[model samples]
Target: MKKLSALICIIAILPFSLKAQRTQKPPLHGKHWMAITGKPLAATAGAGIFQKGGNAVDAACAMLAATCTMWDVLSWGGETQALIYNPHTKKVIAINALGVAPSGATPEFFKNKGYNFPPEYGPLAAVTPGTPGGLCLMLARYGSLSLEEVLAPAMEMAAGYPIEAQTANSIERNKKRISQWPYSKKVFLVHQGEKREAPEAGEIFVQKDLLATLQKLVDTEQAALKAGKSREEAIMAACDRFYKGDIAAEIARGCQEQGGLITKEDLANWKPVIEEPLHINYRGIEVYKLQPWTQGPSMLQSLNILEQFDLKSMGYNSPEYIHTVYQAMNLAFADRDFYYGDPAFSPTIPVKGLLSKGYAKERAALIQPGKNLANAAPGNPYPYEDRQQPFQKLLDIREQWVENPGKDKPGSFVPKHDATYHSENKNEMGWATTKDLAVDSLYMDRLWRGTTSIEAADEEGWVVSVTPSGGWVPACIAGNTGVGMSQRMQSFVLDSILDPYNVVAPGKRPRVTLTPSMALKDGLPYLSFAVQGGDTQDQNLLQFFLNMVEFNMTVQQAAEAANFNSNQLWLSLGGTQVKDRQPRPGSLLLNRSTPDATRSSLEKMGYSLQFGDRTSGPINAIYLDRKHGSIWGGSSNNGEDYGIGW
Candidate 1:
């Protein structure tokens, strides 16, 4: 009897022991490693480059190669904006590899047609893509690995690699779109043998054509270098093959034949935008991001507002801390909607002024305890377009008095506007789209489109953050390039809080919700963070940053921690905002993993909660242990194969 009881007890504890073993930190591996955007093959490919004595750029090249092999939806011929920070130089380089709008684009065209721009500005929105150009340029300037050495890993993977679940999902989601493009469909859907068939799990996938293209570049490099030319010159010579030489001619012909906007002049004129990276100081740590046209500054703005409160004392994910963070984020988003635009066009866009310390202090002072700020107004830095200017004009006209000053404001008269504009909008759409005017009017308005991507190069000790868009929908791919077309109009969505006015503007890069950032403390790399959730990127980044900085959580812990996110542009249930509540620290809504204690506290803070999923965005990151002198990178399993090369 005694033995039986002892055995049972041991069995019960055995499960506990097993659980502990499962949760233990992964055993250490040999150092000097690399991780890329999530995918096993990509990881292997990048590791191969690292092992081959290639630096991060080589690894990045390898990583991109793997992405081409494993995931076409988010990789390949796609634009890449990178911020490569050379730890050695202690300086960051921003690479704008995004495609540019056709010279044909102009904003007046849309208004003239009396048509809202299409979801994705299609043929009209095509831009000269710069992924290949930008990648080659970076290699020319700062890369230690030769083009062949860097591209070899990718070429191998493209020549053959295994397909994963994520790839399948992407194919299915965009099946119709993929099928529409001859090259995309040819490679993605129907190729056979060792050359093109989609691999089942554990099988190798390959891209013979892609490999051939890479090989040609390598051949160019060798020919140039053997002639006693500088390696940079050799690489540039190879790059010309893609931009100004045979490749450009072929691409130009493809676009012209397919009714796309690209011309040989566009390709030849294509030049990568190289600019100084934007940097900001947050809580004694200097953070960095790419400039406007992206929501990178939103993170800085949120951090600035967060610095006002004792967030750490409030605890990680607490309702109080989250509410404060949410409010700050909302304000920052308001500014993003109102002022963020392409600097070349919108000179009045106060990107610097908005990020100024004075602005942050003023915004942070608005937070009130115990209740929400009813009718909370977005920051009005650019009120010229909204109220002040219009109001002053009306006053100048000696307009008749109303019930109240507020009564005449748009928000106050929403009920009246809704009653009038809702029906009027439908009637106007009917008249505008009449057959007589449809094509001509639509053509009159220059449609704008956009694209966004992140790039990392270890050789340069940096990453580039960029969101370039404005011109069109990226649906039509010039067959020769095997790259998809961009219809930037899709960026204009009903989802943005500013939807009605969300039309794409001429020469405007469009207000992107992308917030790519690198966090550091005491001059050491702490995190490389980015998420993809449209406008939610900035909102989500705010919470994650707070979890790490204010809450002092480990990178993994901070990233994995449960939390809520608000689309400052969207609405919530219960006639209230979906908030990160108070009482319970570190509690948020988007994450169902949040503790019950945190939930209860948020409830007390007057928030109605909603559960969300980990698929919010593919959040990818790297954590550096300053004291230990090590770099640990991981991609969230929450969405797709995001942490592929980690």
Candidate 2:
């Protein structure tokens, strides 16, 4: 007990906090409601909304508005995807404001130029910025506040706000890369007609350009209202000002000057879609996720496969437990790399078939009790479909991806990437030759970086969870607005020859990693949550929920649980595996909480275990005690996560 206590104490002092580290900490509880976010001010923003007679949605919007400017990890200049549960409808709905490819983007565009590495940053990486429109849509449709009201906090932030020590460090870490692009440098790197040094931890960081841009949107909406437009119409007017007016012109001019693909027409045509959410019943609790367009379904499929096991008997984080979970996740991820994508783009995507219980049972049976599969290949749920279509596309684009097929080399896998955004700016990082980029593991983890997530629940029984990232880094700040560019288009395959699910298609939304989740207990709303790891979002969520339902941990304890991420699937934004992609053996990463004995047993079971990334995801979550009308709110103690409640 003494030795274990010492280990726990050491973990608590680490710069990056993990779930097991919270074993000595207490859960944050409240009577009225709770709000949690990656940024403390963002959390306060939501709580402030709650105090101002707003519901959960309103609080979420307010938090989002303030959060975009507070952290460099997530931004409104990028895109936002959310899963909202409306008590009025008694249903969970998804808002898909994910950025879409420029209308001018096509397979020939890059192939004609002899391009191999697709640039994920700079003006060329710009897709129509979606977060602004998505926020407006959320407020106009579901929230009580106008866009102006919610954006007020954000505007103040942009004008001038004291930067946090963490934020200053983030800027310092990326300073060199930001300096490569003149416009991006203008806002983030330069100040007072000279190259600005990194600010002190508590120094004021201002984005006057961003303030002007945000103020213009508010002004536009007010003008529309004064012109006799209804509240909804005025909100839409604000959205249009970004996508179709001067802001659009600025983006178009920048992209055109840089020989990029986006145009005014692309911006004008962009609008976030509404999609049907997917859910699975796990031990009487139905967990919900955004459709497979994200990596969300990976968690649902894993849960379905895991349902057949006696998890409690296996023991948490034990050799049996870890191995079983890994196998289940491997099977689910294999399916994800083969079948998940934008349903709007690939009508052929077998979303229902992939999620079917029968399919999960069939896959689960393949897990060997005492060993890891050397080659965990993908399975075909619908053999009748043209499964060869994606392969044929690969053949067409084979020349661009001409890799030295190392059939003779033992353990040779296709090239893999570790970052989310690869830039043409030369200085910007996050691109690759093959496989999906695992952002946090690649570079951001050391700098205490990841995506941003938030959760809020109110006295009125309204609940929401939102994950927002894919901005600031791998970003092309548009014009002089201080609005960072989006690399979400990188989620699209480089060629139309690839599967339609992620093919480079004009106006098609790319399969993204952003997923916000909610859970229904015996048909009643119970929990809402989200996390910040790129590919690990789904995998981490799985670990968190299991800690609670299987181990009987508190909401905060679950939020702090250690997790393992399997990096075997060559999934692109959660879509089909790249054809000719070499298979890598299933590798698992365990947090420090695992015992040496357990590690040895898992290694003996033919699993390679690495120790790093304490929490599977830096999570932010809220759980409601329906019986007492009370709430428990918490953010991951690991990484820079924060939470607040009343």
Top-TM-score candidate index: 2
**CA error at residue 240 for candidate 2, angstroms:** 1.2
lDDT of 1 by residue, 1-646 (tens): 1221221100011234435333112211113443545444555565666556667666665565555434433344445566666677776667666565554544455435443332232344455666677778877886677888877767767677656644543344344655655665566664333433443454565556566667777898899999998989998888888778776776677666766656777777767677666777887888777676566787888888878889888776666776777678767765665446455444555556667777688888887764444333445443333324222333323222211223111210001100111112212213211112121211111100012223333323444333322211223555655554544433332212232233344333444444567766776566667655445566666676676677665654455555566543321000111121001112224356566887676667755454543422345556665566555544443433232222
lDDT of 1 at 456: 38
Candidate 1, residue 319: the lDDT equals: 67
Candidate 2 structure, TM-score to reference: 0.86
Q: For model 2, what is the error of residue 254's alpha carbon versus the real structure, in angstroms, after optimal superposition?
A: 2.2
